[model samples]
Target: MEVHAHSHTERKKWTHYLWEFLMLFLAVFCGYLAEYQLEHKIERDREKQFIRSLLNDVSTDTVKLNNLINVRNQRENWLDSLTYVMNSQNPRSFPPADVYYYAIFIPRSIPLRFIPNDGTIQQLKSAGGLRLISIIGYDIGVRNLTRIGEVEETLINDYRGIAHYFFDGIVFDSMLDANNIPRRPKYAPQLYSFSDQNLHELNYKLFSIKAYNRASRRESKRLLQQAENLLTILKKEYHLK
Candidate 1:
């Protein structure tokens, strides 16, 4: 039998295997770091985009709040004027048509012009993104604004309750004649005629209505200032337009 010469095969060293393992581990670790950084970047960009959108909502709220404030102020003034007329020694001196025009203006409640532009805010809050707003005091500021709005809403609803519960419906029914009410600009039309006793009753109701309006007007003005302050902080903190 011919003995075949064994081919010399060198055994690989354990250190060489260990070196290959180390290289593989390092590559994986670096890839992980790169992926993590990419994800972090994406999250930051998304956060900024959401903040910008939220800023627009706040701006809209600011406009609405201002307009509501103006309406409340004007209505309060009209209520004051009506109070003077009703309490006058000679209620007969003032033309009844003029009284009707002003009295008819007493709204049951100021139309809800206050629309909180909270869509983006609600979305961010629902998604747990409010935590991402890093501006110092921003979160606190937003919370305060919401609280102010709550108080304003509560006061408005309270006044509505007072009006409905305390007021006689006869005045509103007599004042509004839809067909004849809006006949012309600056035109004073005849309203449902009031007897002397009816005038006495209406005079009392008008006083109560004026009192309720004054309370609501005060609340509205306070809310307006708070809203303006919040907007100022938002602009300063976010550098928004």
Candidate 2:
């Protein structure tokens, strides 16, 4: 009877030890799995951050490249203007040779397709003459009147149009006052007329000087400076010269 009781005690101890071993093994396995999952998550987050940083760097570089191109283009245009003036019959009429300052206002709704061809731009550039060609506030007909609200949209559309027409830029010259309106009003009849008369490739700027009713010299200068600042920013930001 003593021997049987000892055997039974030993069996119970062995069974308990086996169960404890299995529980410890399972706990270790679970810990390993949890650690592996956490590592994978951290790795993914790191990759995402790396990709985002790369994209931002690429964007910044693109902007810088564009600015550099614009500055170069502006310098070239200035040189060309000077050359044109030197060869012109009357340099006084071509103020662009010396004066690089002007304010050009583009309308807000005209599509870029309406801009004349590159010949027009080239002619203007060669002439060293600047003018504003407005696409808004002109009476195309008795029923059609150009509207002005969102200037940027009109500008982009006009840009596209000018590009399509092979024009390097636009000119804003829409009549704003009732007195300035002609009897047979048209949208930039002068530009359209020029476009029709001369089929030349032109690459020049869209130019304008805002006509104010009672603008003082200081006010006019301030406005002109503001336009120049905007042009500089556009050149730097978007590489537009």
Candidate 3:
């Protein structure tokens, strides 16, 4: 008789099950990490795009600011000459034509209406995450922009308001035909004739006007420097030109 050995298959050990469970947990964890990493990369890319746009906006602002400064400087010089002539004993030498030229043209470069290119900043604010540009950069940029806007509005607007009142009644007969440069406002108010112009009053008013203009000029300089500094930081940080 042949001895028959009952063959029984060995059951899977508990260690095997434990090892499988570990492997599944590890796979799930790794997949989650990969997904998280992908999301981070995407957000980072979006942030950089926004930064570049902001850089462009700032650059535009810088150009505009410089132009304004230059124009204002020339205006200041013209104002100085006009007031100097008025204060002189021989005010008749300069003639009303000269004064009218400076007054009409200088007022054209009204400082109160400076429009900063803030499209990117507005979008950033609306999008609800300024942290995209980094907390520090965002704060600095916003603060500077706000400061510049406020100063310009206050100082420049004040100057314009004063100019409007001061220039009242001092009319020019040939503003429209004088030069083909700027079109006269459709609702241009008529000016008083040279005979009706009062030199004493004009000279007195000029003192205050000059003060306001000088103050505005100072503030403009400060704004330009600050904006340039911020632009420098952005360029260096982002490796942008």
Candidate 4:
């Protein structure tokens, strides 16, 4: 048998191998850049969505604050009227009906309270998304609002305790109509007691409550301003309406 001849293959040059390695590296690097860009875009979109939701919440807060401010003003006036009538040397000189009406109104009236909408903020906190927002001032404003609300609640509780010493619940119940609305009595109503000590203590509680209400009103106004400021910032930062 005749022997077969082997064909020799040419070896690749070092430069050719280096060129192939460089092409692989370039492909990997380009793919990595593309992936990074896509992730960045997604995050940006999510941030904008969160900002829009926040704007809605803040807008609602503004409306509520406005209404609460008006209520507080009216309540303050009522408190002033009651205190003036009670401060007299002769409490009986004032109309019994008027005294009874204001006395019952104070403790029976519901507190003007506000609860913030924090759904988006809570979501962001849970999802580690607070980093998306650059402003810290908005958070501070919310905390201040919450603090004032707490103080107001505490003052209300104290006022209630003092009111129990001054007014009778039976009188309060009698003044309410079937729908729980206050109506003037056809006959003049009598106070539980016209004791000087009770009147003095009641006056103190009324003044304290008024002070707390004024503070709360001021805080609410500040918070409203802050919310508006935040809205402006969000709109400008995100180029939103």
Q: By the lDDT metric, which is better: model 2 or model 3?
A: 3
lDDT of 4 by residue, 144-230 (tens): 767877776776677777665646667767878998877666666655556778877777788877887788788888878887888
Better of 2 and 4 by TM-score: 4
Cα-based TM-score, every candidate:
0.64, 0.28, 0.70, 0.83
Top lDDT: which candidate number? Answer: 4
* Cα lDDT for residue 5, candidate 3: 100
The residue-by-residue lDDT of candidate 2 on 99-145, one tens digit each, is: 22211212222221122112332343455532322111111110111
lDDT of residue 78 for candidate 2: 42
lDDT of 2: 0.34
Candidate 3 stretches greater than 4 Å from native: 1-9, 109-112, 131-173, 177-204
Where does candidate 1 have its weakest 10-residue lDDT segment? 182-191
Worst 10 residues of 4 by lDDT: 131-140
Estimate, for each residue in 93-212, the C-alpha lDDT of model 3 and write its tens digit.
Answer: 555556556666654534433466767777877888565344345446445545554554454344454444335533533454555353344444433333314655565555555665
Clashing pairs in 4: none
- Top-down TM-score ranking: 4, 3, 1, 2
The alpha-carbon root-mean-square deviation between model 2 and the true structure, to one decimal in Å, is 19.6
Inter-residue clash pairs, candidate 3 = 171-191
Off by over 4 Å in 4: 1-6, 92-101, 108-111, 131-135, 164-166, 177-187
Point out the worst 10-residue segment of candidate 3 by lDDT.
Answer: 187-196
